[model samples]
Target: MASSPTELPIHRFNSFDGVELAYREMGEGRPLVLIHGYFSTAMVNWVRYGHAGKIADRGYRVIMPDLRGHGDSARPHDPAAYPHDALADDGFALIEHLGLTDYDLGGYSLGGRTAMRMLARGAKPGRAIVAGMGLDGILNTAGRGGYFRRVLTNLGSFERGTPEWLTEAFLKTVQGDPVALLNVLDTFADTPREAVEAIAMPVLIVAGKDDDDNGSAEALADLLPHGRHGVIPGNHMSAVTRPELGIAIAEFLSE
Candidate 1:
C-alpha cells in the first residue's frame, strides 16, 4: 500500500546559486518532483492540468516548484543572473534540502529539458519523464533561442502564417515576466546529443501527436538507454492539459 505524507506549508529554499525558489508539497508515498515549462508556473503545469492532484491520489508526494524566474520564485531580468543548468540546479537543491534519496522527476517543455540536463549532470531518479521535447529540439538551441528572443523583444507584428506570429499570440496570454524570460533564453541549455543518449535512467518521453515544434518524442526515446514514448491527443499547447497526459505519467512512474 502507498502512504501519504503530511501536507507542508509553502517553503522557500535557496537554489545552488543562491536564487530563492518556492515549492509546495502534497500527499505522500515516493517523492515525485515536477517542473513546469517556461513561461508557465507549477500551478499551471501541474495543478491546473490535474497532474499534481492525480499523482497525489496515486500516493506519491508531489513536489511542485516554480522555476527560478517564473511563478512565485525570484525573477531576475539580467542575463548574467541566468546561468547554465540553473533550473536543474534548483531541482537538485530541492531534493537535497528535503533529503530525498528515492524519487521520480518529470517536467514539461522547458522543465523537461531541465530534468534531462539534471540527469546529464548526474542527478538520478527512479524514473524520469521528458514531456514536450524531441531529438532535434534538444540538440539544437540556436533557433529556439532566437524565437524566444523575438518573443521577448518584438511584439510589433509577426507576419501571418509564421511561427513567430503564432508564438507571440500565445506568449501574450501567459502571465510571465517577459524580461526574465528573455534572460532565460540567454541561459537556456544546449545539452549535447551524447549527453542525452548517455543517460541510463529509465525515461518516458511524452509529446503531443501534432507537436512538430520539437523533434519526435519516439525518435528521441530510441536514443535513450531505457526510453519509451507516449502520445496525448492535442498539439503542444493543449496536450499538457489532457487527462491522458497525467494518466500516462502516473502509470509510468508507478512502474
Candidate 2:
C-alpha cells in the first residue's frame, strides 16, 4: 500500500552516543535522506515547501531527519554531546540504523555542509546534492557559524530589518534552543580541499542564483570530480521555498 503524502510520522532512534534523534518519512521506494538547513526542521526545509513530496512522488522514500539540536531531535545542553563533526556522526548513525547500503543523500545550507562532511567521512550515496552551499562554506564554517553564535548569544540585541534581527525572528519562530544550537556550532569543522576534490560520486551543486551566503557554488562544483551546478530561482532563504529547488533536485537524481 502506498503511503499518503500527509502522513509523515516522526520516528525516533538512539544515535551512537545514546542521544535520541528523530526523523520523518514519506513515500516508498529507494531511500533519499535529506538533512534540513540550520535553524530549520525537516518539516520546514523539506516538507513545508513541498520539496519532499515533489521528490517522493517521483518514487523515492524521502527520509528527513531533524539534526540533534533542531526539530524533534533531542537537544542536549552538555557540550560533550556535540563532538567534532557531530551532524555527520548522526547522519552516519541514521544510515546505519536504517540499514541503508544503497541510498541518496542531500542537504541544504548547514545540512548541505553536513552532507559534504558525510561524503568526506565516507558515507557513500548513489548521488549527492549539496544545495545552498559553497566551497568556502564547507572549508570554513566558523565564519557562518560565528554569525549564528552571535544571533544565539544576543537574541534581543538586533534591530528590525537587519539580517541578524531576521535570523533571531526565524529562531523564535522555530523555538530553537540557543544553548544546544551554540553547541551545534562547535560541531562545525572545515572540510579539507583534498577531501572535496576526492569525492568521486556525481554531485549536483544546486544553489539559488541570488544566493552567495557562503561562497561560490560554481567554484565548489568545479572542485568536485563529478560535480554539476544547478541554478534555481531564489536566494538561499527563498530558494528552498520555490518549486524550482525540488525540480532541480528531482531532475538531477533522475539523470
Which candidate comes out best when scored by lDDT?
2
CA-lDDT, candidates in order: 0.83, 0.92
**Model 2: per-residue lDDT, tens digit, 92-135?**
99999999999999999999999999999998899999999998
Off by over 4 Å in 1: 1-9, 159-166
Q: Can you list the residue pairs that collide in candidate 2?
A: none
Clashes of each: 1, 0
